[model samples]
Target chain A: MAAGAKLDPGKVRGEFPLLAGKRGKGRLVYLDSAATTQKPERVIAAEARFYRESNANVHRGLYDLAGRATEAYEGCRRRVAAFLGADPRGVVITRNATAALNLAALGSARLLGRGDEILVTVMEHHANLVPWIQVAKRTGAALKHIPLDRMGRLDLEALPGLLGPRTRIAALSAASNVLGTIPPLAEIARRAREAGALVVVDAAQAAGRLPLSFEKTGADLLAFSAHKCYGPMGLGFLVGKPEVLERLEPLETGGEMIEAVHMDRASWAEVPRRFEAGTPNVAAAAAFPPALDLLEEIGLDRVRRHEMELTEYALERLSSLEGLEILGPANPEERVGLVSFHDPLVHPHDLATFLDGEGVAVRAGHHCAQPLHRILGIPSSLRASFGIYTVKEDVDALVEGIGKARRYFQG
Target chain B: MNLDDLYRDVVMDHYKNPRGREPLERVDIHAEGANPSCGDEVGLDLQVEEGRILKVGVRGRGCAVSTASGSILAEMVEGLTLEEAGRVARRMKGALKGEVRPGEIDMGDLEALTGVRKFPVRIKCALLPWVTLLEALLEKEKET
Candidate 1:
């Protein structure tokens, strides 16, 4: 349905019931999709359907209910693999992006040796950054950084020096959660691979906003959360290459992942199951397919175009406002559909409160990238992000609310 | 979430022109407190003599509720006996938790931030500096 790309954002807003209503003094303008996306009714209905019609432990019982559950869960895995252009056998689902990233980090600890290095960037959200730090500490690997340039972009010029032979792994984010800066991952992945380092990309902010192909990016492992993509929470996935998957140790052990269990010892199941030990999030797994279906129906290329247009509009509007300093790249094309700004006259907390009074929702504080904020010389900032439902009116409302907040505080 | 209730004229004035936005030259106690969720931080420096606070100062970055409350706290604690300051800190905490009645603490400018009690999640912002000051005082007592 590529012809459906003609649908207007304002018209499609009705699909998300939360965006259809008014709050406080005006219509609710949700600009915090980077934090978590609003679930479509179909996605919510899918989860409820599984719980009501087919409720049973997957891969456990030989009965019809168990068979249905197993079929649905594994079917979603194939869908996710197809969506990412990855092999289904390599897809290991987890609780969320944090769990997925931790699985990659903790599971890949054996791959690193003493005096090796893990190259990272300062723009990573704690989920991506902290796990690598723990992995380095456990493996005697030194944690190194690809520092940001003057414009907050990753310093690719320094990549060659950082990705030397000692670099065992290079962990990077496809898009920064705070700055909205998308790194040149294909190039970075090439360098890491040439240096014989494994590449792990955190797609937490990039997955739904932009198109991603696991093979094309050349990442050995990738992690992303489903809740940020109009799906249910408590669901995320990590996909690794077959060879890399074979080397990863399972982070957890128990019920569902044992191949053969004596009273004393056991053998792990398969690649994905070995990593996923507990009872799977059966309903969540079944529900996640509808989100992919919706995205495919809308077409990801169209989604990216819609977001880029809005981001350009938002950047121009925010730039025209006095005292509002936008962070990240100067070009809207170089960033995602999110803008983090600092207003010299008003604190972010106060600005967010004032915006709430006007029925506008924006994220305040560090957005879990505290170190990035500190590097930018701000304690925290205000961020307004976009989704398929966002329209010109939302950005216009945010600009107006910001003007009011500045006036109220300065007066 | 009404802005008027949370940000009174007094609170805004203190925030815009904080009383003790600089560090004290010679202080007996010093401590730093941070609100990791919001990334608000405050550093408290106090010079105590015998059983009284001689001078107190606060400096750092944070929201209006926190910065204004911190400035007001510096003014209120100065020249007060350590015991009296402790009593005032307890009253402020009680008011923020909605456990104390009006006029119970007699905090003057500090009362402007009592509106934060309505927003339970933000009460920690208003309480950060005062709690940090108390921490310095307690540490000094332990040392002595």
Candidate 2:
């Protein structure tokens, strides 16, 4: 699937009400999809429909409402599992990607031994990095970070040496939220496997855009957020291999996740339910099927191509602007549909403010990756990330807005 | 809101050519404040003599709003009695929240920062240095 695979950017824009709404001067050119995507109509309607029609407790109750609600909720689980090419039994619903990462980290605690090393990269978002830090502190494990090359790609050459026998887990992000670098996951997974370390992939940035099959990906566990994929907020999932998940101790405990409860002790439920405790975000989970439907309708292969084309256009436009320095790889193929940059005369906050006035929404500051910014020797950078609805005209508007910002302060 | 309202020429002037953004050799009180959300930080170096701020020094790297606010704060607090400096910091904080305005007080160059009230998210940026100054004053008072 490529650019013209039955997916029209113009039509896609219309499907999102927020994207369709008019700004004072122009339409809202949302370039902050990396932060959180504007929800499509199908996803929005699916969530509202659940509340309006059948809202009941899932995994409990014998009434018809409960049955309907359970079907809708579990249906989404199966759909998402099939989409990621993982066993439905292994998919555990989460509040967001951060919760999933935390669960993965805490659950893996029993596997870690004193003096073991938890390997990660400097490019990881704080969500992926901090949890491992806590685990290392809790256990006697030592934490090490694989440094990024000057181009912001993981220093793969050093990864082999870093993943020694003492490494128990290698936590890495599938894509850099700041630099947009798509690290070679297969190679890293292979090295981690050879080093006898479990591989945890934070697919928060790469989930819907990339065609990821849990089996083919060679990762023992993967975590991602739904909001970043045009799905409703407050919903995400963690896909773990059954044997690997069985080794993880559940981070949460309460109703629904227990098989038997005594006065003092309890035997937990199976894998997915064991991790999910108490009342889940059922409405949001029900909406996830439609979100996956939207992705399937457009096809992930075409999504990849569409974003690559947009990234290429964005790179070319950004390169032409004076004083703008792009971070990460120069080639669009090496990254996703995002570009982060620093302007010599304009601070990212000032740049974002100016762009906001021009009706272009972009993210600024450290983007929750302060270590990467520190490594880059900058306080903050401006980022513009694309989505399915983004078009060439949107890139043009961004370029025009940058020109206005340059003249506003430096002129 | 217009970008000019937030990034006024005077604000840019202070940002481009900051004043007193260096470490004082003999500091009586030093306090650090950071807007962790944006990774912007402000460190204050104050030298007090006879219950007054003899000198004020500022250090940090941040956006135009933060850097300019720090510069204006460094210039404002020098040679003021500790109580008077506290009053100024309070007034600046009030101005950022729209509870006070430039004409309501003798805020001098800080009047240029009143526009920051419109950008709620950036109000913390404009007030980080002033907050640090207030903390340093409290620390100095505690030491005395």
Candidates' C-alpha lDDT:
0.88, 0.89
lDDT (Cα, tens digit) per residue for candidate 1, span A1-411? 557455378766877878877777768999999999998888889999999999999998999999999998999889999999999998998999999999989998998889999999989999998999899989899998898999989998888778898988899999998899999999999989899899999998988888889998789999999999999999999988877988988889998888999999999998888888879898999999999888777888878888889889999999999768899998877888899999988889888888988889999999988778888888899999999899999999999999998888888
Model 2 Cα lDDT, one tens digit per residue, B1-144: 877788888899998899986678788788999887677777888888887888888887778899999999888889999899998899898888788867888888888888888887888889899888888878877887
- What residue runs in model 2 are displaced by over 4 Å at the alpha carbon? A1-7, B21-26, B99-104
Candidate 2 structure quality by residue, lDDT tens digits, A280-370: 8999998988888888888988888889999999999988998788999988888988999998777788888889999999998899999
Best by TM-score: 1
Model 1 misplaced stretches (Cα beyond 4 Å) = A1-7, B101-104
For the record, the alpha-carbon RMSD of candidate 2 to the native fold, in angstroms, is: 1.8
Report the Cα lDDT for residue A56, model 2.
97
The residue-level lDDT of candidate 1 at A350 comes to 84
The alpha-carbon deviation from the true structure for residue A59 of candidate 1, after best TM-score superposition, in angstroms, is 1.2
The CAPRI classification for model 1 reads as medium
For every prediction, compared with the true complex, DockQ reads 0.76, 0.72
> Whose DockQ is greatest here?
1
lDDT of 1 by residue, B102-143 (tens): 577577987788888877767888989878877876887788
